[model samples]
Target: MPVAVGSYGQTQPSCFDRVKMGFMMGFAVGMAAGAMFGTFSCLRVGMRGRELMGGVGKTMLQSGGTFGTFMSIGMGIRC
Candidate 1:
């Protein structure tokens, strides 16, 4: 009798898994982009100290959430 080998690419991830992965990736990218843009824009507007921090944080969260939602939807549809 021949022994069977284990296969690595046999299973497909669930829809929720795909969506979660997409959301996490998109959120990370969005947060980085938002931070860069927010910092520059806030500085240009003369925001300083706590105000700048607040603005940047807000921008990061909003952009991250938006990107995550869209990504999750797209990924879910692929499954």
Candidate 2:
């Protein structure tokens, strides 16, 4: 019997995987950015307590989604 010396495996991620990774990274960055900007804007606009929390949350989600979508598309295109 002969022994095989080489191993073969998937060296690249699939399209879906690339998109997913991009989305996750973009989402995180977007959320952080949204938080900083949202906080200042909301505060300057006089939002307080529950309103402040709601505003920030909304901003975070929106920005995260937008960023994630674009990043995913870019990643997919590069593939």
Candidate 3:
């Protein structure tokens, strides 16, 4: 199907294509958010474990969680 160049170039993308692309982009972002959360959680746990084994780790899990959430939001992460 040949499209006239000027009209084709100006055409808006269809709704279905927009929805599919949005879903794909959001999915990638969601995966990145999940990874970030998992890593932060694991780090917190390791720090907690270290407290018992004798390392001078501060109790900053709450701050870390807040930081992670804010960063994800700043990155425009969406479902």
In terms of lDDT, which candidate is strongest? Answer: 2
**Per-residue lDDT for 1-79 in model 1, tens only?**
3334449635566678899999999899889989998999999999999999999999999889888889888998887
- Alpha carbon RMSD to native, model 3: 10.5
Leading candidate by TM-score: 2
lDDT of 3: 0.49
Which should have the higher TM-score, number 1 or number 3?
1
Clash pairs (backbone) in predicted model 2: none
- Sort by TM-score, top down from the best: 2, 1, 3
Superior candidate under TM-score, 2 versus 3: 2
Candidate 3: count the clashes: 0
How close is every model to the real structure, measured as TM-score? 0.85, 0.86, 0.41
Candidate 3: residue 58 Cα off by (Å): 28
lDDT of each: 0.89, 0.90, 0.49
Pairs with backbone N, CA or C atoms under 3 Å apart (clashes), candidate 3: none
> Which residue window of length 10 is worst by lDDT in model 3?
52-61
lDDT of 3 by residue, 12-56 (tens): 444555555555555555555555665576566675565533322
Candidate 1 clashes between residue pairs 3 or more apart in a chain or in different chains: none
